[model samples]
Target: MSSTGPLQPLTEGGVKHAIVGTLEQITIALAITVPLGLACAVFLNEVPGGYARFVRTIVEAMTALPSIVAGLFIYATVILILGLEKSGFAAALALSVMMLPIIIRAADVVIRLVPSSLREASYALGAGQWRTVWTVVLPTARSGLTTAVILGTARGIGETSPVLLTAGFTAGLNTNPLSGPQTSLPLATFSLVGSPQPALIARGFGAAALLLALVVLLFVLARAIGGRGPGELSRGQQHRRVLASQRDVVRMSARRPVPEPAAPDPADS
Candidate 1:
């Protein structure tokens, strides 16, 4: 009897390979997207008038771009035009493109919610526009900005077409984003489920379950990191408060009137 089944791949570390590839794709996507998105949000917030409006409109429009379009764009630009290989990096580029619009639009909204009064206060404190944005506006919108990033992650993570077109599926673990094929969770599951074997289909379901767990884990981690909003005292803030109190105590002690050696002076005299 011949055993021709997808389970053969599972028994040979397929699940682990898929898990690593998925994580790698997301990590790279986030690293590229977050900063760019934040910067776009800040620029849109700081700049006023027609040009900014025009740019914002374009970014907002991009939010509606299809995943396959993004994938094809990356495939064409990076793989074909730039002559780069179809690798995890190319896939990450596609994911980042998909993620960017979501993040930028959401972050712009969050930044806009920051009170004008805060900006005025920052200006009154001698802060420049950029400084005001960096210190006051961004901090005020920290939680919302975190949410924006998470929203982008959610938008990109489950995208099959983009990862499929750009990432190119691989059954083995490939850590190097710049070389060779890497498969994301959705792509991996897609590949596994397409196999004509019940065992492979089961493996695909398992992969899907793992992907869901990964999303939950990411959300939890994001919440942990971005839990505090403006005016909320974090551990660092609490420590600063303690230090300030200690300094006040020291200053008060230093200012206390010292009995001028009056007793000794009188006794000596």
Candidate 2:
């Protein structure tokens, strides 16, 4: 339906392929990444001492590692060793590894952001540490954890080099991760932009825009549902305010004066 040249038809196919591939890759990446990332975060957040710092340092370093490095590692280890050809599943695994540190750090930060007083209160109520973390910490910081996972997924979805090297560029739709050439959205854009067709370039732009839209959608959706509710407003801000209010109340009560002795006591003195 586009008269904009040969680029147009090529682009339509590219867009369709990119959208489908990206979605498939993201689904796989999230499934494996979220639970593991959160688990790592829980350990780091709940545990104390120099050990946590060591783990945090490792995660922080991993977060900044280049995408190509992750791709190479996966290619050599999983692809070469397993004798599996480049596939979407491999790409997803590569992306998940790259994404893990981000989600873990984000979730750990959120868990730490939970009020110490809340933990104390839970303990006061005879809750065990594990129970407190499971029931209190997680519920309170659920939104942040969800947002972290979503953000990690969004970050992974845009990966091009990893998908290119691991997933490979294929012309047809592939739903199965275990076999066949699967074309992903980023790889599609990378492949299409090099073409001399203006229509293809436009399609690339549209695809890029769509990818951005998806990321934004996920972030907003996750943030909206994270924490208590959208109506609760900023969870961190609310939590801080509540803490301050409690402190003020405590101070006020501490300052309250006891009743003066009766005049009869003064007469006796």
State the lDDT of candidate 1 residue by residue for 1-269, as single tens digits: 02334546555444776667777888899999999999989999898889989988999889889889999999999999999988988988999999999999988988887889999999998999999998899988887798889978977888899889888877777888789988788998898789788778878888899888878876887777667654466798799999999999999999999986645667676
lDDT of 2 at 102: 87
Global lDDT of each candidate = 0.84, 0.81
lDDT of 2 by residue, 1-269 (tens): 11234534553454565567778888899899988998889899888879988988999999999999999999999889988988888998899988999899888888888888989999999999999988988888877888888889878988888888899886666778778768887887777677687777777677778877887887788767674631245768889999999999999999999788866656667
Clashes of 1: 0
Tell me, by lDDT, which candidate is best: 1
Candidate 1 least-lDDT 10 residues: 1-10
- Which candidate's TM-score is highest? 1
